[model samples]
Target: MVSSAGFPDFTRVVSKTIHAVVNVKNFSKKYSNQFDPFDFFFGFPDDFGNNRERKPQRNDIPGLHGSGVILSPDGYIVTNNHVIKDAEKIEITLNDQRTYKAKLIGTDPSTDIALLKINEKNLPFIYFSDSNKVQVGEWVLAIGNPFDLNSTVTAGIISAKNRSLGILRGETQSSIESFFQTDAAVNPGNSGGALINTNGELIGINTAISSASGNFIGYSFAAPSNLVAKVIQDIKKYGTVQRAYLGVKGIDLSKTEYLKVYNQETHQNIKSQQGFLIGEVFEKSGADDAGLKKGDIIKSIDGKPIQNIADLSFIVGTKHPGDKIRVIIIRNKQKKIFNVILKDLQGRKKIRTKEEITPSELLGAVFDPLSKESKKDLGIDYGIKIKEIRTGRLSAIGLEEGDIILSINGIKMKNPNDVNKVLKKYSGDVTIKSIKENGQVYIAGFEMN
Candidate 1:
């Protein structure tokens, strides 16, 4: 409902979605700071690990009072990954004030969506709207528990779409950042709220805001319901996201960037420079097999025009490995179309379900082969550095971020991919030879129970 001045009347929409929205509280006991204040300032031996559950010296405890949306009538809910991350306890408060301890079903940190389950049944839920059909300037109502106040509704229009804010890029190697931009007043407690349309359908999940004061300052972002819908299904099925990869490194281009390129080059004449420019193609990649090459410009995919990297990510992130997509690109000033099959980060054309794999088989560490310079410096010819420790069962078992893996079960690791291949085929007890940054070497052992 809209008035003459364009401000929407969100009466019925609020009534439909308010019950579905929940207030999520993530409680945490005080933890000793991981780094010693004096040591951190003076560069000495520090408290390297966070010892949580210790009695606090003061009363400053961390708490997360966020929001969530019920996705089904049987107590399934959706929220942001950061909301419940590392939470010792998750307490969900319904509209009727009934509280339940939420069970973490799964989480995709790249997309920032988490699925939670409660024992309650016959709960009110909201259906997802076709976010691709959502247009700019369409009226939207954000319903949540802002500032810990329940059932708050604010009306605004969809300010933009396919917004790439670069918030999720550092979270993973394959982060998706296509967000729906809106002007709704969102604050600290609105992290996982519902963004609904005029018909009261959930179009997006209010996740972030572009603000300097840590509060809503007219600009906010949400995970589109279309991507959310796909991720939720993957989480429920595979216990993780089946992120498909096109396997091409590229640069998003504009006319301004095209002009800069044209001025720098002393070669043949170039034109039509408003698309993604493929800079490199990895070996044994989907792009390589699809006949894509460097210097090619991707124009569209599956009849949809791609404006930038965010658009490309949104298109590919919704798909599974082995799914074929038609890619259109311009090569040598000529338009060409090729059918390309997507693959996962493991270079597998097929994704193995969670039930078919053990928790230890899933190595959650991103790795980089030790460089020649590094190998020469360290006096080691076979090793890989743990670049980032992603969330998994392995990470929980004391795997620090900077640990360099040398071997597993006496099999020397030569590169980043060597460990995964070893883990994929091996079974039973898991043992790893690793070296710390302080030149201390140790063996980490665990089982597949």
Candidate 2:
């Protein structure tokens, strides 16, 4: 016979988790009359048959609501980037129904984490658990304000980890994910909240749930605490993440069977059954500088055997720029060694300068100095016209074939030379404001070392 008293009571855990959940309400500007190509070609009204006279104008203010978790004793909160993105005003409500204005400290969309600060201090916060130690069947709790409901607490167990479902903002493939999948119910307003373990320790941040009907269908994912800690620390110190780059492009063996066959035929000396094949290395990149070539098969990095492209990317992301690492490569049935210094995605070596381009290796883009005609037509005093977007940071950010740069970090662009000069002056995340062909303005920010 089992004693019920010896069993852990989850009721207390739920109560504590609820206390950490917060209500985040923000004011967002709703842009009405947004241009639609389909509607334009068919000659439909800008509102798309909505009763414009009866409805409020498009530029009217809209109330945006979401959830968050108290991360510190001094009123520091963490939430989703999409939840508070472009918010005009942010107000936080506590478990006691007390409200206070919150200020955005920093945001990293790569991991969908945002840091916010409230006016008050000595607030109650939940401590983060070691997510790496959490097992798949361990009990967990999710706390958030879902569907405008305040401080809701749901219970479940860890379902999976290291999940990469490819549901992230922006079109580019980002390298910030190690999700802890859970069965806890999560919804739209639950973003930026807490996912806790049995002991009331935060293990992950509730992010996304997979469903066909736009509701929880027994699958949910949270950003693991390890990655969340990195993003939070980076955003606090540098206003952006200092992501490390490996500089070599490759495909995963699971995705490409030819690479597997090539590995068996070319590298007989290599003992490993799986590793990354070196594709094209960027000129002057860290890998190229380290003597890595296109034909070399990466056997190991820093003593860890490379299993696939994801393994390579994960290992590279764990390093920082200027850190020297040893790479083992098998080339032409011969083993070799290469010492490489890691670089940022932009291929920069240092963190002090804002200019981040090797002019000779611009990576397939036709850039010209800012011209008077370009600036006048774009309705900006400065910016460069992106004539083409080859494969690199620019192309990754959805800067298609003909986007025009308006500014970098709020500075006006004068030309390509001006863009380069201004870009080199900053070292962390740089926001590029540009206009599309349809005259719609969009901003893309990238981190440079």
Q: Residue-pair clashes per candidate, as listed?
A: 0, 15
Write one digit per residue (lDDT tens) for candidate 1, span 206-324. 98876645567788889999999999998778766777889997677754665457547736345545578887898887989989998888999999998888888899989899999
**Collision count of model 1:** 0
| lDDT, candidate 1, at 352 | 77
Which residues of candidate 2, in runs, are more than 4 Å off?
Answer: 1-8, 30-63, 169-173, 256-277, 291-315, 324-340, 349-370, 374-437, 440-449
Model 2 TM-score on a 0 to 1 scale: 0.70
Using TM-score as the measure, the top candidate is 1
Instruction: Give lDDT for model 1.
Output: 0.77
Tens-digit lDDT track of model 2 for 1-449: 12388855678777776877899886644333443221211232435565223232332143557789888888989987767654656789999999998776666656667788887877889888777688998888888987889988888889876665555524235545557889999876787889998888989999877664456778778888777777677656654456667787764444456665666677633333577767689888899887899868888888877766545655666566777889998888899999999887677665422133342122225666657876677666766777755433454334565777777778876666665566444455666677776777876654443
lDDT of 1 at 53: 31
Of the candidates shown, which would achieve the greatest lDDT relative to the real structure?
Answer: 1
Each prediction's Cα RMSD?
8.3, 8.2
Off by over 4 Å in 1: 1-7, 29-62, 255-273, 361-363, 366-388, 391-400, 403-449
**TM accuracy, model 1:** 0.76
Lowest lDDT 10-residue stretch of candidate 1: 35-44
